[model samples]
Target chain A: MHRQFSLQPFSRHYSHSTHPFLDFLDFDGSEPTSAGEPSAAAHIVVRPAERAQLLDVLAAYKDAQNAGTLLTLTFVTVNDYLWLLRAVSQELSQLGRSCLYYLAAAVSDFFLPRQRMSEHKIQSGKGSLHIEMDQVPKILKPLVAEWTREGYIVSFKLETDEALLVPKARQALARYGHQVVIGNDLHRRKFEVVFVSPKASAPRADQGESVPGEHYEESWLRIDLEQHPQKEIEEDIVSELVKRHQAWIAAASAASA
Target chain B: MHRQFSLQPFSRHYSHSTHPFLDFLDFDGSEPTSAGEPSAAAHIVVRPAERAQLLDVLAAYKDAQNAGTLLTLTFVTVNDYLWLLRAVSQELSQLGRSCLYYLAAAVSDFFLPRQRMSEHKIQSGKGSLHIEMDQVPKILKPLVAEWTREGYIVSFKLETDEALLVPKARQALARYGHQVVIGNDLHRRKFEVVFVSPKASAPRADQGESVPGEHYEESWLRIDLEQHPQKEIEEDIVSELVKRHQAWIAAASAASA
Candidate 1:
């Protein structure tokens, strides 16, 4: 997301008050000073324990870079996002690799036509502003069916009210015929999410019977971090996804064999 | 505005990778440290020049606190805001103090009826979700006329399109019968604004003439930040506002005299 949306690197504007830590780590990206000294590095003070932890992080970052593990791609506008999907579709076809589409962008539901948009800034002389916008095309259906049919798709449904959360998520899952719909409330999105799957409610899954449904059985990967305040929900979500992907790969290999 | 509407302070969630600053600042609002150290002093570090600048800030902060020059009332919800305005109204009547209302909050245009809102979190089981919201009452109109009457009201007009900016600002100014309407486009809000006043276009104040009709007496407050890349636009904006406020105060005094 930073690759496409942000003008400056996220780290650059992390915080004015917090730059001392970055400077202490020798990762401050500020330009060279007139004195030719590392920008305020001599002034950075930290405890031995803190220094050691930062060093560990720097080492891990360098290791990841050396291992060619990072992919840098950014899209700034809606058009850029559309173009990125097309590019990814072509690349995935060439590589013959199944992908996981984790959709988490805050997409606008409606938009004004680009051509009709004023070239210059809008003047405030008009009495009350009334905008006419057309609903944006729901692209997830085409993406699921045409672009990445073999891939697993996890879509997020974030609603302001708790009442809308589950229903909208189920609707998304049913509409797109996707693998998972993670429902989250806008107020508590960071800590709680309900993973909805179509096959989870099937009675025979508990009996270890093959359910007559989609190739992959539906299930909800429910993780609540409310009790464990220190734990990150993403850690559990990522681990569960990795396991699911491995299982899918192993099952496909067994079927072919 | 987080003091009014946000669940958490913005700085708390600022860094995705580093929570060290929050830890150091003890702004994580977690348990007290064993050492009982003052978080601000210990965590702060700066270069020689920056240290001098910080000293100046500290001096000013101390002066303000010593002089009892700060009002630290905090509101955390919509109801809180409403109550605060009511309290202020009563206080203003007793004190008979004029005000400069600078409204900068991102207020929601619509809200679900409180009585109809779901008591529990919305469940994801329902197929599709539909939401019906009602327009929020236009509180600013009453605020301008009844609550903060005899005060100079400066309202902000933010628009996405550049072309609609000036027109919308003028419209707001005319509709509200306010002193100043500061117009900004979302795309370039940080650096530029068009300050629209009904008096600006009025036949030259220098000429001591009165002009009829309001076409547009707009003044653009543009900070060409290219030269001084590190300069904040707020610094310029605040300085300009100070002059305008001084002028307003002087005019009020002279008119009474």
Candidate 2:
């Protein structure tokens, strides 16, 4: 069944406090000297007021540039993000089975349709403001079936309620026919995540023999903060995904042979 | 008549692209070497992923720290900004006529009340989402009457429609009994601003003799970008406000004597 969806574009004034990527970097409050100095080398401090400058700095960083480790692009609205994602995915699809799509960013679930939006600022004289937004269309279906069918797709499901994680992840996999869904509870996300995927022996949904809960498998990955105070949970998650992708590639090659 | 107001707190993920402050800074696409090097000294570059680090860098900047020019604070929600504004104004009130409040930030007009918020993410299974928000309270009333009665208060009115600028600004001054309301159209904000204030010889609103259009005056400030490309409109705005503030302080001193 085809579904009609709506999305509202939300924008905010830039303030450094809400930056998402910088949240991962650890910094000491001490001052650093010149760029080549030992103190400066130990800590990298940047104060980009907007995204363009931030991307520019990241693109120019000596370590990242030498390693060819970072590539950056920015989008303003929901539609901008969607278009960029589709274009990038299509380009990556050229790699076929080697490409692994790691979908992480939390795209807004709802948006205000352009037709309903006011041209001027909504004035406060109206006592109260009522806004009816439409649901942002689910794009995972197209990403899996059309954009990159041979690529291994791993999507993320973050939930405030812990109980919803596994079920939501499973539902996403079934609905989109994606390879895996990494489910994480909001509070416990830093320390734990569960990977939900179709079980190796289970019948595929396309075969019309698949059962709901019985056809899926859940593998939990966790880290001990006490033992490894400095370790990131992403390290473990990425390592596991790398192994899975390798196996998938090997199986595809063997089946073709 | 007592008016009810509603405010919604809107938040966004940090993407350098939407930063408001950085929009003012000029950057050429060039790399910098060491801090003491002439090339590095010529241009300042910062890549702050979030607000905290950005503030930290600003606080630590040598020029600002030595000049005692910059003080920064960040607020996450509308309520937080309101509370902070109130507390700061109350403290500044002690300065009496010497204090000047330059109210600029484009505060959100509508906000969802805590009681109406959903605990979990709004599922997209529902076809559309409907939200009714309350108009944010007009804090200027209390700010002028109570927070700092003797202080010079300058509020701002920004409108997409040019015709509404003067009327809206005049209405604000009459309603709040403040000293000035700087009105500017969104498109021409950077190039021009209209300072709307009560006429010097007009009867005060407190005297109950004030008329709407007759009692008020407007002084337009404009900067020709082609003639003076390097000049900022704020330079003129501040210089004018400083002169007026000196006159206000002198008048109060003479009256008290």
Candidate 3:
């Protein structure tokens, strides 16, 4: 079975598991059966703080599913999103090369830790306010190296400057040694995107090889909004990733054999 | 004719006017008709930044009104809210003692001014991010003394510490020389609120008199959720405020005569 995990702060919620293979497979107490076509199942887990709201969301998801449309909703803080990402990646590692991860959420780069946050609202009696926030740990590094070694992980790089898109995407891929980095400019994101990944012969950092700028490949994807106003760029993006993921799975299987 | 102006940073779109008495009354190109019962008209003006979305909201508001419900939506920055408040208050001042300003929105105390804001997104390469924000100007002072001299203004003070409610509310009244300050604790806001105002026969600071701690009166309003789960505390708050506003109007008329 194909498992998907999606996490977003203050909006979407999906589960991250720390269980073994059997426990993961038996999430809904159903045995896996081989079928001609691949089927996907998504699980959503919410924090204990919002348990009451979680129940309401669960009921709503159930109603939507009954009507043939799958839907889930929950809210999370930045800390919760990080925790869930780590936990979910470790659990999905059990699937080995069969997994494909698409990370599209706009996660905040900096956040005030719980200990440093003010208990009461900051009084305006002070003339000015100064705040210091720590950078959120880059979780993709551990996700690629330790959490899910064989999985096809895709991360996004969003930039306001158009010139920085390709370079930033390459930097992310080099830093984290991930499968793909999709770069999009803030204003032009709707119609265009660039996918940056390593060339076939390029060595991965995790494999003890230093990857350079020449070893990376960039592919641009564009859709004409005037030609097809109803079309979404996500369709092209998903199709491209699916093809790459299948090749990855085949390469992993062949190496194992 | 009664005119109401509401301003919120985001989610609520409202208009603030800088027009004269005649221009304010002729907002919709309609002449004012003398009606026995007080009729209220609300105008929503959006900033030029969201002019496109404003049209959509206006259309939505029209649809909702046609269906027997009034609804409006728009988003604004802290700066927009302050500007709208000042402009709207100036226009409403033409109504003299008939105007009542209810300031319930939870405006941020600090904000990064546009001139100091970064042109691009702050990079995470820096270990920690330090941001300094200027204190948002306290607009209530101008709204009371300069914008609307005879208007009955009610401001809100929300505090985490319950003990600070009455004291802070009184301080707001003494500082701004406004008619009322509604104090509510952050946690118990839904069920309880305290109205702090100058007691009858107590001198107001705007009247060249030194108002002391004992001069302010605090009236608490509470609704038990167990007794009436469906009831909202706002209902009681509005009723009390309406009574006080009528008395204020009468007092202003007597002084003018």
**Model 3 steric clash pairs:** B14-B45, B15-B45
Write candidate 1's Cα lDDT for B60-158 as tens digits: 444455588655455655666666766776556543335666676655555566896787655433333455555556565676667766666677878
Instruction: For residue B110, give model 2's deviation from the true position in Å.
Output: 1.0
Question: Would you list the rank order by DockQ, best first?
Answer: 2, 3, 1
Instruction: Give the interface RMSD of candidate 2.
Output: 10.9
DockQ of predicted model 2: 0.33
Each prediction's TM-score versus the true structure: 0.58, 0.77, 0.74
> In Å, what is the interface RMSD of model 3?
22.1
- Per-residue alpha-carbon lDDT of model 3 for B6-98, expressed as tens digits? 332221332212111111111122332363211233121223444444334434443454476532332267777887778778988999989
Candidate 2 lDDT over B120-239, as tens digits, reads 877777788888998888889889888888889988999999999998888888788889898999999889999999988766666432456988999999999889986879889989
Give me the displacement of residue B194 in model 3, in angstroms.
0.5
Fnat, model 1, is: 0.07
TM-score (0 to 1) of chain B, per candidate?
Answer: 0.72, 0.75, 0.72
Q: Report lDDT (Cα) of residue A66, candidate 1.
A: 55
Between candidates 1 and 2, the lDDT winner: 2
List, residue by residue over A201-224, the lDDT tens digit for candidate 1. Answer: 434222222333352333344456
The sequence of per-residue lDDT tens digits that candidate 3 reaches over residues A1-257 is: 11122322212332222111111111122332364111233111223444444334434443454476532323267777777777778988999888888888788899899999899877788688889999998888889988898788999999998878887887788788889999999898889999999998888756433567898999999999999997889889999999999998888779889
Off by over 4 Å in 3: A1-64, A67-73, A207-210, B1-73, B207-210
Q: What is the TM-score of chain B in candidate 2?
A: 0.75
